[model samples]
Target: MSDWGVDRGVRVLKGVRHFRHRIRRKMDIMFDAYLNSEGDFPMCDSPVWIFGRSYSVNYDLDELRRSVASCMWVTYRKNFGSVGETSLTSDKGWGCMIRTGQMFMAKALILRHLGIDWHWEPDSRDPSYLKIVSLFADLNSAPFSLHQIAQTGSTLGKPVGTWLGPNTVCQAFKKLLSSGATGLDLTMHIAMDSTLVQSEVKRLCLSHPSINPFASATIPSSSIINTPRIDPKWRPLLLIVPLRLGLSDLNEAYVPGIKAVFEIPQSIGIIGGRPNHALYFIGYAENEVLYLDPHTVQPTVHVGSKLDESEKAADETYHSQKPGRMSFLAMDPSIALCFYCKSEADFDSLCRKLTDRFSVIPLPLFEICERRPQDWTTSDPIFMSSPRSNSSGGRNSPGGFTSIGLPGSSSSNSKTRMGSSSSSTFSGDVDDEEFEILG
Candidate 1:
């Protein structure tokens, strides 16, 4: 007897009809499902909408470390033998390790949420990796020997990889947005001296030259978007920035707007003595603020040496993992740095939401980036003075939001003077003090 005939004769006791066809169709569906899975399936990433553009947010840990060369490698050990194999060096690059993992994760989250394209592994020609890498290192492509610098009496010179400061990160972010990668036209209104901002990017590129860092890429070039001023059209992503702020102001000034309509997330860099540690503030529960810790190594789950299973497992692990959280006491020195948006009328709506929630005006944002312990007393001006015209003074910002025109628009060639001093050391009025200067 045929297989179906034999099965039917033995299993005909049930009242179900079309059982054979139903079983075959179900099997077909399962087969299709298996074939359409990640890694093995080779489909585009899942789409996430941002600024009216659809971007793929589905990415893995390996894509996170591409920009920093030294931190790209991961070591593995074999259970059965003494030796283990190291695969692709794409795992999340742990630069500052316990210190700055949060910053890396925060940047990764920002980039992911914004839907900007990131690492295209083993593809040297792609610019996305270069852009992200610039955020980590100077990217001049210098020789390895020059990358390390020794301190007084230090036998081994410390490896000076291309980890950027908070200011540099802000500058690099503006650069990326202006590069046409982000569909929205954005401008960064920095409160610090413009000359310092210009010089910082130049210094990074001089040390590391292989990456061929663009000079214009250093600053967001304060420019206005001339796109069709209508719905679904490009408008300025105005970034109102501050150099630093105390913990109280961190919660009072930045936190409310953060909790309100706009989604400009703040990253806490330079906590107490740890300059490398960067924590992205997610939200607050009572007096405590929750954040994501990227210091712990996220492993790539594998099984039986099968490519399909390993890929599937890694993807599953990424989705299931949750960001770690912490309380307010965890923040030493009680200082944090961040940015607030002040773009179009929609931003006014966001401000309105903040007012309704907290009954406070959203201007004059008090933000801070902690200082390196040694340089804490250096008194460079924290508050920006009258900047050039394109960058203006108005009620919109702590300093004010000035529209820097298009990419090629005239910028002041004259450099603004910068102090060797640091913002952490402030003798200003205690009432006016935005940052908790831990003397």
Candidate 2:
């Protein structure tokens, strides 16, 4: 047969198939739309159309949260244990204190949205691996195997199996960018002590020429937010709050840095809850806040002494990242850390949607929703006090947590306030004087 004859025959077959399929597709679409319109049809909040046909399916919020930031999920078990703090994975393990992972996760989300690659895959042939290991050891005073580093996230400057607080992460971020090794020219400002960071960076550069991390880093004189110190604006500024902050500070500092998905409020990892849990807000409803809890129970047990086997299980669990919702009253975040664009033009655009109010930030209900008896440890009351309340208050009664003192309550009767029963010693972002070693 001629080429044209064969082509026609094939086309005829395709046309008949297309006609049948198109009719079927149309029927499916009409049926789906009809079902979706009915209240009885079970479907996700958002409609998902497949091949021009709407399908009713219920999807969880984790899908939305991950989609928001392209978030990287690293379980606390893998990251914390690779660093001497292995027992932190325990339910009541007070030793688990790595708020930096929460901060890192938040930054990874921001960079993912900004179209910047923030994380690096472990490669055995890379020379930078040695430096990362050495720096991590120097910071933590613990030894780590290259295999451990490759399995979990980079340990860089984190002590093996120990506390990796937010300050260390902020400082390490500076060093990574400064070394001109990572190729990330990000700027970080220590709002609490810009001078301390400046001096520390300068000393490190001068003291160690070969291993001098952060040699090319810039030290700012003032805060990246609410300060007129930095001019000719810099893009992508990551702010670290190592001290206690109020709702007003969180609103003013974060709103300006937020963009649609990349710069959203959750990019600012908030360390809250008892035992200093680190979490990032995904979204909020009328009285609920959606968040991803980095701290979860270990998925597997370490069989004998095989750390690698346990870590592998942890890695698998992390891939299944999940989002959770809590009463706005229960999410009592103590610190807020975020990444921002500091350039004048970009900063304005970032802050365009920002308002003086924290409506965008999923803030917990700090006001006392209900007064509980001093022994009523059923709920945490420390979160109930207003964030605007004065820090200095009467000491907490026995079996009670510290109270910022209830509103309209006198100091003499402050003993009547109730709070969470967990120990107040948090291992996250806090001053040296404020931190207590918990095992």
Residue runs of model 2 more than 4 Å from their true location after superposition: 1-69, 78-106, 109-172, 175-181, 193-235, 241-276, 297-317, 342-344, 355-439
The C-alpha stretches of model 1 lying farther than 4 A from their native spots are 1-163, 179-232, 236-240, 247-276, 298-309, 313-320, 332-343, 354-439
Give the per-residue lDDT of model 1 (tens digit) for 1-439: 8999988876774535567765775565445433422211122353321121232325632232222221222122122111112232322332222123224322333343233343333324223323332232211121100111101001111122223333333433443444433333333343342112322222322342232123344344321112322223223233323333333222234334333322222221222212234444333333333343434454433322223655434323322123333333334223323323322344344334433544454532331222223322222221223211223222122222222122343431111111213322222221222222221
For candidate 2, list the clashing residue pairs, or say none.
Answer: 44-57, 83-160, 83-161, 84-160, 84-161, 85-161, 136-157, 140-159, 234-343, 237-340
Output the number of the TM-score-best candidate: 2
Measured with C-alpha atoms, the lDDT of residue 41 in candidate 1 is 10
1-439 per-residue lDDT for model 2 (tens digits): 9999999999999999999996785565445433432212222354422111222336533334334234433333433333234333222232223433333533432342333333233222222222222322211222122123321222332344444344344444444444344323344543331111223222322342222232343522110111221332233455443333222112223221222222243244443432245555544432334455556554332222123655334223433333454443343223334434434344344233333233445431121112333442222212223321323331221112232332354431111112223333222121221222212
**What C-alpha lDDT do the candidate models reach, one value each?**
0.30, 0.34
Count of backbone collisions within predicted model 2 = 10
lDDT of 2: 0.34
